[model samples]
Target: MADIEDEDEFDDLLELLMTNWRNVRQRKMPTSSGADNTAMVASTASTRKNGGAKDDRQLAEDAKVEFDMSSGDSENLPDEDEMEKKVPIPGGVDIDLNEQAAPTIRLNPKAKKVGAPRKSKTVTQAGDKSDRKWYQQAEQGRQQAGEVTLRALADALAREMPSLVDTQCRLSGVIVKFSSAESKKPKLRMLKNPVVTMDPFYLLPPKLLDACMKVLSVANTSECAIEVDGSQETRTVAKKDQVETVVIKDVGNYSRKQIENFVRIQNLKTVVQLGLELHKWLTIEGIPALPAKYHDVANQVAAQVLETYPYTQIDCLPALPDFTFSMLYRAIPPTWLSDASIRALCVRLTHDFPSCRFAGFQDAVPHKTRTRRSSAAPVSREIQDRVFQQVAEEGVECVLLPLNFHNTHWCCLVVVVSTQRIFYYDPLNQAVHLKAANAIAQHLKISGLQAYDVAAQNNPIQFDAFSCGIYVCWMFIRHVVRGPPLDMSANALPRRRFELFFYLLSGRLLTREEAEQHEAEAAEEDEKMPAPPAASNADEEEDVPLTQVAK
Candidate 1:
């Protein structure tokens, strides 16, 4: 209450103290604290307010002397704390008076004096100076912003291309499209926007893949196309006067195939070409060839086609083995070895592709601790565990189960992952292994596999009793190759067997080069061979070799 009149005085006192503090800071003077601070500020203000100009001169001289002593010639400043606290504040960045962020300004002990002339008086406010120097004021801000943008760009680029940093895989990359014939490397081709990339065998046209798959897709699923003809090169099956050409129908029914333009086609070569494309597509999509997933419907269509069209042998060469419809290579029927053959085929497929798993035909033997009431043979927990783990790890696309029901006959069950369907294939009899198939399905369901419905396949029929095993093995191969169609008669099996033998001997899938090589050979053969005897207007004019499909 007594200091009510002093309210204005107190406010003035605070203002003067603040002003005094600012002036001391500019000259780097030691700041006095507590009661002494208040007293010194009050006295200075009173002296200036009363003594006017003369007292201000004294204060100014004192500030000049202080600055000269601290920062002029001597390396050491007596008031070290004063130098640490009183840093040169950056000009004109907005600072909150209520919550000022105090900066820690370190004064180097052996500090070299900054190359700036000292001003006699302090200019506190931004507006006091006519020259604001906008560039200087925003220097720190600009640098900070630049760093942030650069960081962001670096992060984005890394995500898009981690290889950008590698010298081998520099971001400034080039692509070279060269032929197998080309010996010398061409000049580097700069990658343009929307980069065009292709496989190593890019020489083969992409359009051919669809055409080839279309023919193969049907041929593989159908067993009728799996045929052999050693003298197929010499034989002419059909003379179509309507098309004015001789069309060899090949071993199986290629009734629907349009082979009206080529020199010749070897059926095995076509199968090889088809197999090659299947592998390429599967590899591209990361789908397994044998016992795979996702590419089911397309595979099915291709497989079904195999049943309808026999693999036509058009481009048969003299050097290649005679693998036609002969008794020497006739399809052998399965006997006691049927079970072993089927199991062996599954094993072979599994070994070929890591994605495939073969569940064998052999039943688990009962354990010594088995109860009399338990009529079913006991399964080895260790074996079951291992199988489950393997299937899980391999992506569970397809499982081939070759069953010998009641030690009587052979049957195949293909478990497709994506479709969740078990293809129950028994060309001789579908009812042969119903109980066994059911039991297998139940076991799979119980053993943590996805539930699968048994779907009947129009299996290829066998002539001899032993052919069931052969059929089962062939089916296993088909599964690995995304399936070939079922053959109607057991006659085609011999041809199919011969093809399989060639594949095994070669130990590699046929490529575009192989097909192209055969084409060259066919062309040579056509050039050497004489023109066919021309018939009447109703008869054919020229030969139309199987050129309907390509890979």
Candidate 2:
């Protein structure tokens, strides 16, 4: 009975071991036949450790069936022993092999998002086909109109003031209508109170008109025209009943004296012509006259003529004439003869041709005489020799000899050929000298004269004078012996005075000592005491201090 019980117990033990082994083996085995061969071998070995009899048939079958497990199959299988090691303890504590590997979840589509639209490629048109036809036509038309207007203005100006075309002249006037039985054309008139009517045909010389036309063309192209109206009324005859009737009335015309004065004031060329004629007759009669001096007089007459008509070079001489005659006339030096005799001779000569007498001489000769004494004593010959010696030592070219006429007046006739020019000086009238200098300077194309001292050993031929008057008669004669009408206005006189003052003040014609003295006197006068104070300002208070006020 004991033997039989042992046998049974052994069988039961074998069965229990087999059952545990099978469970472990099933857990270890891969779920698919494609499991890794290494894992299958490990399962078989583990099953043997559980004390189960090795099943050769199962081993052989597993070997025969080749398993090909991928990485995913291997990751899905769990180790039986590792699972057993992680089993929950008796205290109910959970076991983990490692923190569970977090599964990756994609949530991109669930999130809110904002974005710009993608740009599409743009297509360009062929070219600019917009119409510019009207714009181009308008621009061309404007240019054409401007050109036409400019041409017409130029044509009109060419018909008027011809000289004004080429030369600079200030034009001031208005347009008016005048009757010519022949044709109709707008006539330009002077804006004077009497409405001076000018002949359109003879308004300007042909040369002047042509020049004016060219200028007008250029000006018209550059500028616009300004039209003006006259204050005077035009006389018109509308019907036969309103025929132009004239009543014969004794309205005294200009008297002989008035006419003479008018002519003298307005016609410088006429005066010059008359003087020239009279001089010529005087020369032919062999009146023991000074021809050289007369020539000088003729030149002055010509200059006066030029002053009248500055538009044309006709009748004006090309070269300057000598001014010696004008200088002598103005100086009126005392002749060796008696004063009474000289005065008598002057009266007779003037009386013989009163109309031909010079306007200047008419005013000046009456009080002058041959025996008039000079204010400054005559320079002695010895002094002159000493001056010459000194001039020679200083390398001077020439000497200026000043001749005093009346006690108040003096003159100088410089005969220095070193500069190939002559200079005249009248101490009584500085304008005459400056004009003469300017005329000579222009003619000779040489530097103008300066005040020189003829006595100084270092600088000879330089002298100081209270005043000087130079004659430019020769230049006038050379330029225009026969010319157009002259203009007589007081404008030249004032200009001459101004020029003389400017030259003198500039120290161009004065010695250092003379300039200094004149300046000192002027300063002294400027420094004089002020006049009595005027009444206080109306806005000022008596007690208020001027310094306290806001500026």
Candidate 3:
């Protein structure tokens, strides 16, 4: 009994091992869904039990048969159609893999392959299979349309014949109308104002424009049709006598911009009248209303300027609107001061200060004259004569020589004629203009004048590109008036420009006392006003009822 039990135990152990191996192999095999793998497992277990006395070769054969059954298609395996139905596609659409897919695009049914030319299928008559030639039909159509085929040509040509003739007639009429209209139209009036013709103040100066035209190689005169309203140009000068010379004092009531507009609108009869109005507006009102920072513009020199303006002489004034002080006063983006401005200012300065001779920009040196020239003769005798003529003739104390560097920068040389010393004042804080200095020294030598020392004066340094002109003007003022130096820092440049413009326009200068008094009054007024409540920012006034608001 013990021996029989051992044999049965060994058989059961062998069957269990075979069952586990079959399961592992079945999991790895690529079998179809619904395949009965259990059949192979059961068959292998039965063969092992039945063939307990079988040889090793027979056992190996049974294992091989089990593997083949699992590898090959099973009787319970699902059909292709059923498997296709069970499979899931990405977009939830059934795809047929059996049938060939139709092409997305098809070639045109009548298109011919690119090779030898073939006859066209177009028929000349209905239901006729004869090929029609395009060139032959086109030639026939053309010949029949002409006098060759009288009957067919008459029928086809009759319809479009009038349209062609009518079109030609209409085009002729349009051409005639255009020519007549051009002839009838009045000729465009050219610039006829005498002030424009004379080119006063160098506004649209014909000589300069013509020179530019010559440089540009433009030969036509009609290209330069600078339209100047004849009425406005003539009326301003014509009505000069009729306009009143009243000084507008009520300008203080308006804002600075409004006052500027008022000044622009005023059709003053003379420059003196304009000067008086500017004096009232800028000196008495405008500068006083500015912020405290700009108060420095009102200094002793400005006061002196106020006392000496609107001179008895009439030739001191500039004629063109562009060169006028009204235009120069605008310094939003400061521009280099024009030679005309410097010349006019010099003229006025000479008239005011008889002892100090002022040289015009042109008289000092020719336009764009470089000091780096190899020739020792810096300037021509004519220029030297013009420059030193006043100094020699009047025995002037000093000569104010304003120099324009490359038409971009401006600096001034204060030549003390008596002492023979030249003080250079450049806003850029650069080294003394050596070449200009050498030229001046040479001019003095040729003219038999005393040799002067060119020394650089300690002037305020300009931090910007366009403020050189303002600095030059300020230096000229300081040398002439002998006043304490005013602010010329980068921060103060704008106000300084305003001051210069006001000085030029009003013929008035600011005084320190006036500036201080106005500032004190403004401060006192500020002190008298009530400050806003601390809670004002947190809650708006409208949110809190007016009745509940703090007084």
Highest TM-score against the true fold, candidate:
3
Q: What is the C-alpha lDDT of each candidate?
A: 0.43, 0.31, 0.49
User: What lDDT would candidate 1 get against the real structure?
Assistant: 0.43
Q: How do the residues 438-526 of candidate 3 rate in per-residue lDDT, one tens digit apiece?
A: 45654665466556665667667778877777677777777776546787776666566665565555555554445567789999999
TM-score of 1: 0.29
TM-score to native of every candidate shown: 0.29, 0.16, 0.37
For every model shown, the clashing-pair count is 40, 37, 5
Question: Measured by TM-score, how close is model 3 to the native structure?
Answer: 0.37
Location of the lowest summed lDDT over 10 successive residues in candidate 3: 194-203
Error of 2 at 449 (Å): 15
Q: Which residue pairs does candidate 3 place in steric collision? A: 302-509, 302-510, 303-509, 303-510, 306-509
Off by over 4 Å in 2: 1-269, 280-396, 399-410, 413-551
Q: What digit string (tens of lDDT, one per residue) describes model 2 on residues 398-434?
A: 3343333443333333424354334444433445333
- Write one digit per residue (lDDT tens) for candidate 1, span 359-475: 555452212333354555333455456556655664667777666655656666777776877676664754435544555555665666656566666556656656666677677
